[model samples]
Target: MAAPGTLRRFLATAWLITRKDITVEWRSREIIYTTVFFAASCILVFAFGFVKDGRPIDDVASAILWIAIAFSGTLALGRTFERERYNETLQALMLAPADRPAIYAGKLAGILLLMLAVEAVLVPLVALLFQAPLFRQPVLLVALLGSGTLGYAAVGTLFAAMLVRARSRDVLLPVLLYPITIPVIIAGVRGTAAAMAPDGGEMARAWVSMLVFFDVVFLTLSLWTFEAVMTE
Candidate 1:
């Protein structure tokens, strides 16, 4: 077991990092607005292009929703760390005496909160625009969204940190992120689609379970590799 003082320091460090990122974000408000607007526009474009004869397919709604989230999330993750890289704050943070994993956790929490905020609006907009009966499977929808977002953020945070100093980070974030996160994305779309289906309860449960499993695994992997990647 860790000593009380050590535990307190760890928690305090994590909180301070989170608070710092939040404070920065609150001041600028750039990422929140950009991510939300980008996601909303994607949803509107899909609605316009795919809503056939004044009606959209229920099956397509889930796919569209996840796609919007994925794209916006990629953009948000990249920018979150890019700010640190540009300002040279990431190196300063690394040079601090705080725990490295705490820095990773703080960053992960900040990015996750931003993405969730974006999802909060985007989910309902997709439902409204596509006429999806999303509320019918409230539990399933919440489970899939939470797990999918958690897993995506976990991996995205690590990769974004790694690519922070890269020249082509804007293009590379998605290229590296998507291939690894395909399982989470697949589970998200499948779980969402199943929830929308009339007899897809069992399948939805399976996909949600897979999402949860993936979240645990990927988050563990991120935490394990974060310090090495950040220091290298």
Candidate 2:
């Protein structure tokens, strides 16, 4: 690979960080098992309310899906940075020569990857359990999940890093995170609902467009503030 421009270098650094996190998780199987289990268990618990005598109540699948994503995502984000905090590497990472935003991007990417893995299990289980035709509009569904998760991960990555130095980080993460990400969770739920709607995914396109726009805005704000946040 040629080291041509700043973009290449940034991406290279981000990938290295992502690979490191993933490699560690692969060896330990901690994040994956924990996230997936939490997400799955969330779905099963909701099964009681959503599933009727034999079928799921109308429009429940979308709610269940997003709830699982949000809850499990929080778990992944907290633990992802906790490793850095516990290993005493976060300070060194902050002091590294790389752009702080790039480091943030790398951590964000790793969390998103872990969440996606959890979603892979969650989505299929949702379809099977609730009989939600989630695959009806695969492309649209993917867009909603991708953009929504991006928005969620963008904010989460920042907060988890900031709270890495705090004593009550685990307690503080969801408190700080949920209020900002409600829009993301709502967009994801709405778009996903539209995608599986019998109306032929008409409104899903609009929601997808809006969610993508939100992703851009959230990521911009998060990246811009990352350096300042980490400095303290």
Candidate 3:
């Protein structure tokens, strides 16, 4: 595709990039399969390692859900950008006439969608394995997961892009991302736990609101700095 020539084409450019990533992944299915397996394995390990009387300890299910998300998300982010780096297409991508921030937005949107799809499977599995009532408040639960995952992905996409050319990015990605995303992780856990409770609507909504705000802040920062950050 040719480089975009006008600021008016920002969204179009972003969507084009997103479509490219999605099409590539659709052809290979490598990232999604590995991410799902890794996330499922994390849940299973937590289930077995932290069981009490053949059941996971109280509130452990929520924690496990977020932990699996964070871990597997980092894996997905690393590999997503790694493909560009490996193919030596990142420079070519950056050199395109499209807005750099639009590129970041495209990557963020694609990664966010992928994470949500993984969560759709992970959530049901966690409910079954841990006997948690994750779907009792389906609306609130989805809101929390969606907002929280957006916040997590907003930060992750930026860092993964920034570190794409680094030698130690695999090790460094989590090192940099986990600490920064602690608030997002905490909010996700709290909101999910609340949504699973019988009378926790108010609390769940509160956490979801906070997560939305965090998403806004993180995304704004990421988009604003993406151009300068990606500079050689």
Stretches of candidate 2 off by over 4 Å are: 1-4
lDDT of 3 by residue, 175-231 (tens): 999999999999999999999888999999999999999999999899999999899
14: Cα error in model 3, Å = 0.9
TM-score of each: 0.95, 0.96, 0.95
Q: Tell me the spans in candidate 1 whose CA falls farther than 4 Å from its real position.
A: 1-7
The better-scoring model by lDDT among 2 and 3 is 3
Q: Per-residue CA lDDT of candidate 1, range 1-232, in tens?
A: 8799988887888888889989999999999999999999999999998898889965899999999989999989988998999889999999998988888988888888899889999989998999997777888998889899999999999999999989999989999999999999989998999998888889999999999999999988998899899887
How many clashes show up per model? 0, 0, 0
Writing each residue's lDDT as its tens digit, candidate 2 over 1-232 gives 5356888878888888889888999999998999898899899989987788878898899989998999999999998898998878989888789978888889889899888888889999999999999999999988889889989999999999999989999999999999989988888888899899889577999888888888899999999999998886
- Between candidates 1 and 3, the lDDT winner: 3
Residue 154, candidate 3: Cα error in Å is 0.4
Is candidate 1 or 2 superior in TM-score? 2
